[model samples]
Target: MTELARAAAADPAAATSPEPVPTTPDGVPRGQPVLDRLVALLDLERIEENIFRGVSPAESPVRVFGGQVAGQALVAAGRTVPEDRHVHSLHAYFIRPGDPRVPIVYEVDRIRDGRSFTTRRVVAIQHGKAIFSLSASFQLREHGLDHADAMPEVPDPESLPSFADRVSEYGARLGDMAKLPRPIDLRYVTEPAFLSRESGPRDARHQVWMRADGSLPDNDLLHVCVLAYASDMTLLDAVLVRHGVYWGLDRVIGASLDHAMWFHRPFRADEWVLYDCASPSASGGRGLATGRFFDRDGTLIATVVQEGLLRIAS
Candidate 1:
């Protein structure tokens, strides 16, 4: 989708017709059991030795979400690796907005399989062109020295406002977007972008509590893939809040340029995790943010860094 299309989707008054309801390929409505549908999305269809096909939710946003593509790519990479190996790190770049109307084809290249580490590269293609690419490294489990920063003292996830509760103030502005099926549950410790933009010029820090909205089966790869999808939901809001500008409320636009994640320890995505995020710099029409994932016990399990295009219209 183009910039104009994004604007139109965000502005209810600009909509020319009723927004379409999302559905499954079998023509079943999809607003409930959202997590089931999400898991299905990650279940890619293998078409060749190293090629797989995945699809987007019906009537998706102007573009397929960045996290969806990233998560799906990881699934493709994981499928080609040995089950004994687990993904330790992944680096990905979003080259273009994905088209949701069609299926995405992921082509995987086995880069290396060494004594302790395995690496794979995946490219997500649509209409025979590359839209995204990722390189992931898997490792055989082994003992390692461990140390991490302590999790800051903050209110528990239950004390914070849910995403729906936080956005209730926006009223009809968000339309069905706010009401759509959400597979991930998010609660904010700080004012969200929409709310912060009114009184902010705040610090470049954002903290949120996140977990899958529903129960997930016991699968290590599935848990990690789910975490990858949840990571992109708000990692960049820290940048916008620092300037007190929002996407629709302000004359601003943004897109993920690249994302990288490192897994430090095992964790369940269905359990609450604190995502502590901050933006250290933004320049040349881009903003860079980093986040650490900590389980409820305050054990750091993962780290993420992402740079995104944040164009402010003057």
Candidate 2:
């Protein structure tokens, strides 16, 4: 077994458990448990060498979430490379909407394997056509000039109300918000961008504390992939905040155009990290946003940038 696999085996949380009903801080039962389902979502089924199949959990029926494909494609690429080489960067583009009713097939291309760095390209296919494509770079451990921006001052995660609590505050207008699968527990430090029907005087930035709802194995790849999955949850919300448009509240339509991420340090998905996000610009029906993920002690773990198509119906 690989050293990383051994580490995962050592983690007690790797053991399977019965699924539980999801609930909020106020004990309102909502949907099925999420951690196990998330694990299943990431566990791609290897069909053949360099090819893998992944399925989405039964959550939103409209379309497969973009993050799921990105994470699974990373997993497919990681399987082809050695465990010692960790992923440092990835760039991906969504070509078409994924059909959640069907499984997605990922094909990994062995682009290059160098002594110091490795490169991989992954294509996600459904309906015999490419739905998404990604290129990732991996590197061996090496020390470099260490510099990062300081984590911004914000209320501790524990001090804020859970996302479940915030959603419950919306009451019936948002429907059964708790019924949605929430694998990552998010605590907003400010009023959620979707709360108001009109744009306020607030800036086009947001901060939230998030972590996997349950413990995960010690596998480094899994942890990174999980973070990739969670990163997409609210990054684009920064753009919506600027226009005072809530996805469900207004006649707004949006889809991620592309995503890019850089891993600066090793971090666990089960631990609290603050995600600070802002939209620098929006024009010609597209909006660009950037974010920084910081650990509880103010250590920068990762940075993300994404551009998405945003249009509000007249």
Candidate 3:
């Protein structure tokens, strides 16, 4: 038997008959079609007791986006866990570029289960090769000492131009990209990386307001997964903006190497959260970025750190 099948066979909890699952979670809001696709993306299919399958959007880019895999892997891990337990942290590595044309299979291994904490490791595979892996820890509700960094002052998200409005100046230059589905609403507190490239080099820090485009079902894991999907949307930009470089505009090709996140305090992904991102250092063709999510009331919600491989041409 396969190692995963043996593991499932060995566990009484997993040996029981499996239940039916839907491609997308129930009560998926439909008013926002793009967001609907995103919601459907996270709802993985239960391939077996310990394996799940996910698909990329039909309009996926050349390669699968890192965030999509991370979020889907987390959803796979979360599915093997209890609803009462909430994921507190996750660490992931991108081993290889994912192929958007095929299905990605997620294999979940129950690492540990304690009274207070549960952990699972997920491997995303395609063509019988591991493309990505993630380990996540879940914790039951508990009271403990608490402290966090104060949030930075930023203009209201409503005051800032919507992503489309802000990028309208690029017009024909952005072309098809401008018409793409945006499941997450973005509001930059300052000039976005590309716009700043035009303005000239400046600081290493920038902030943006982020949230799901529409209402989400009342599920903690789904919310966290959505935020995970959104995290990669502009994290690499933090690195590029530091040197005033852009993707197509500059001779630069970069990919996310690893991603880590720690969730703190309960928050809704549908509600606006200020994402403060900055790159601390760049060397050896790699750049590292750190980000913190804060709610409208300035309460810290989550923290993220990512490193990417950036090959820049002189």
Candidate 4:
């Protein structure tokens, strides 16, 4: 097994079955909770040749995160490609809010299998209607001219405290922001939490260090899903910072409208990756942000772009 797989195996928390369930007093599975359990609810079953169906438990709101769906769809598609090939890019659209109470069916269509690259399209359906779609490309790694931009200098993840630690330190002062489900550990290299008073004029740039709470599978597909999950965390917020609006502040409302990513190289998600983000424009109550992910060795693994609905309270 690869190091990632070994690490994942070592983590006691990573072995939970992908079935949504409520946690007991010790965070072990008990029954099921409406929102919290959704993260665990993807049932994979074969439907057709080169196609699979994923079902989720019935709940009012969809229990799956958009990134999770994208990542899972990528995994389904990756299964059809050669193990040597790695994901290079993915573009997906969310057509409707997924219904948690209903199960989603993902149909993967093999578009082409070329010598150097393979392509696939995934359509996520619910209630017999298409609610999400993704197109992904995979490529085999080959030796060639290689170069990458310098990694951004940032404090190590160890030097900074986890977001949860900060929240506990702040207590009720965190307000509704504390309610956000923080599955990954995040430490801002530029702006510390709850230090808005020290924040000055908005800048387009942001840098942070991140890694999964535990190790993940060695499979490139799983790493890509982890990247997809982390990609959505702060790209939109970078735009808000450009406008001098802290998301935690009561004066602003923000939501991701669309997200896209391009994987440039293979990298382990279990390791620390430098995320450098910037916002180029914000107008008409909308904002656009772009980001790049670099491994510790300065390999540019991925590039991301996102547009979000940003409305400042009047």
All models, RMSD in angstroms: 9.1, 2.5, 8.1, 5.4
Worst 10 residues of 2 by lDDT: 27-36
Write candidate 4's Cα lDDT for 1-314 as tens digits: 43333434565455444455533233323321321232333224556766666654332232455665776677677767888888888888777767666566888899999999999998888888887788998998888897777777777778986566555644466564454444455778767424532475467777778776554544567778778878877777677666566665547766666778998787887688988999889899988999999887778988998887788888
What number of backbone clashes does candidate 2 have, counting pairs of residues 3 or more apart or in separate chains?
Answer: 0
lDDT of 2 at 104: 96
Tell me the tens digit of each residue's lDDT in model 3 across 57-89. 887778998999999999999989888999999
Better of 2 and 4 by TM-score: 2
lDDT of 3: 0.85
Screening candidate 1 with a backbone cut-off below 3 angstroms (N, C-alpha, C), the clashing residue pairs are none
Report the C-alpha displacement of residue 50, candidate 1, in angstroms: 0.2
How do the predictions measure up, each by TM-score? 0.89, 0.93, 0.89, 0.79
**Alpha-carbon shift of residue 22 in model 2 (angstroms):** 4.5
RMSD of 4: 5.4
